[model samples]
Target: MKMLAAVVVLFLAAGLSDSVILTKCGLKQQLQTSLTLPPNTTNVLAQIVCHVQLTSNFNTSAIKTINETEKPHESQGPRRGRSAKNVRPTKVTPKPHLESGEDKNEFWTLYGLFQLSDHVVCNSTQRHSLNLCGLTCNKLLDNDISDDLACVQVLINKMTAVIPDPETAKHIHKMISLIYQPECANAKASVYFADCPQP
Candidate 1:
């Protein structure tokens, strides 16, 4: 009985060892240092902090599986011969089965503190990934978040480019304002980290 108890304790310790629950202040400091924003960008850092807090709650080992089904294109109509009653759903092969032993069809997975997607941003054992970040998905789950921040910068740059107005494109805070409710705008970035210990 004692031997079994020792094994259980060790197993729990090993699982906990890989994950780091970061303090809000720690996360803020890391973001300030790691992310490269444009000159005079305001509240963008806080917006990121709010986003991360909502997404993963500062847990380094956070992961979420999204079951995404392929949507039919707007231009494509229903099949010519198949009626609604005759149509059947086809099962697609699961992509990128993780080494961690989850056998379900994980269409897309959000990983780590920032919840970066394995489908386009990071590579995994799963096939048919765009791998825009050119790094492994496992890297995002570790305590070191510099790589994750670098990828975020890439995504931000891409997003800003899509905006027609040059002034709005210069800052991501404007983008956040458009997406989130007015009450939850960049002004509330500090609110997300209010619980953190102050210096």
Candidate 2:
């Protein structure tokens, strides 16, 4: 009986330590700097920030669900609480911590995804385009657009909708091509140390 109790305790400890907890969540501000992004772009970039955060949330939730399911029910006695009748589980994943530096993947990595420093020229030319892209992307994402190509379309279609003044429209039109080019299309999303791109 003592041996069995020790084994059970060890199992509980392991599960407790293994929970899918996140350590920190904000890396958005760092990338928002003008050196990497324009000041006015914050609103549009906010959309991107929301996008990555949603992805992280989904990850945490899915992990929680899966972890909960995989764990065997807690041991129960006839007198245990009502929950004891079901398979009560100890948390298997650690909760996420919100501090940035502590967990690169849980915080800093996702922060990088919102960093749009790579193409300043393309970005500048596409400010309206990008902002419009962000709006449309949020809309489509609300409706569901997981792949890269679909997101690119969101930008293009939104740009087409409200034709801006000639000069700005001309710039937006230029951005349309730039966005779909392989490099931009293949832009990476930094997901807490993992690549959150579609296969």
Candidate 3:
């Protein structure tokens, strides 16, 4: 009985230290991700959960809305064909296209970008999380002013052959820069509820 109590106390301590402000969906997502762990480990880890609050202006509803409505451009490029004169089957398979359809939801896309930014911030030359986000946003800027949709669209476009023009990239860069600027204090917000794992 004493040993069980100690384990409970330890778990409570860990949970308290890593406490975060997460939405209902965010907590659900984390539980789902945790379930993926091996059964043996899952049992041991199930008693403890950690949440970190990050700076982000996004919400679950916004993510869901965008993902369900947006679609990536389809590839209209020509396909390779083997003529009778060259009758061998082509060994090379075409590259997998990045599909942007109604299914491309914002939750996963934002999640992935934040996850990547986190990794880059921790492991790469970019030591600051805001800098890492800026680096990505800079590439998407198209004009003097930037909008959230423009940045998101550029990111989506990057998955395919359609590259954003310089003007567009500038606009996005400016927008992202504004968000990350010190006055806005929004850079950290990007990290908010960023790692919620869902079923």
- lDDT per model vs. reference: 0.61, 0.32, 0.28
Q: Which candidate is the best by TM-score?
A: 1
Mark the regions of model 2 whose C-alpha exceeds 4 Å error after superposition: 1-25, 33-35, 58-199
Which stretches of model 3 miss by more than 4 angstroms? 1-6, 15-99, 103-199
- Count of backbone clashes, every candidate in sequence: 1, 18, 28
Tens-place lDDT digits, model 1, residues 90-179: 323334546545754445666888767676678877655656688999999998878888888777666646756564343334323322
- Of candidate 3, the 10-residue stretch with the lowest lDDT total is 57-66
TM-score for each prediction?
0.60, 0.21, 0.22
1-199, model 2: which lDDT tens digit per residue?
9999999999998765422323223333333332233344434333443433323321222212111111111111132333211222233343454454664442111101221111211122322232533332223222122222333434435454787576556545544433232212322335332322222
Q: Pick the candidate with the highest lDDT.
A: 1
Cα misplacement distance, residue 13 of candidate 2 (Å): 9.6
* TM-score ranking of the models: 1, 3, 2
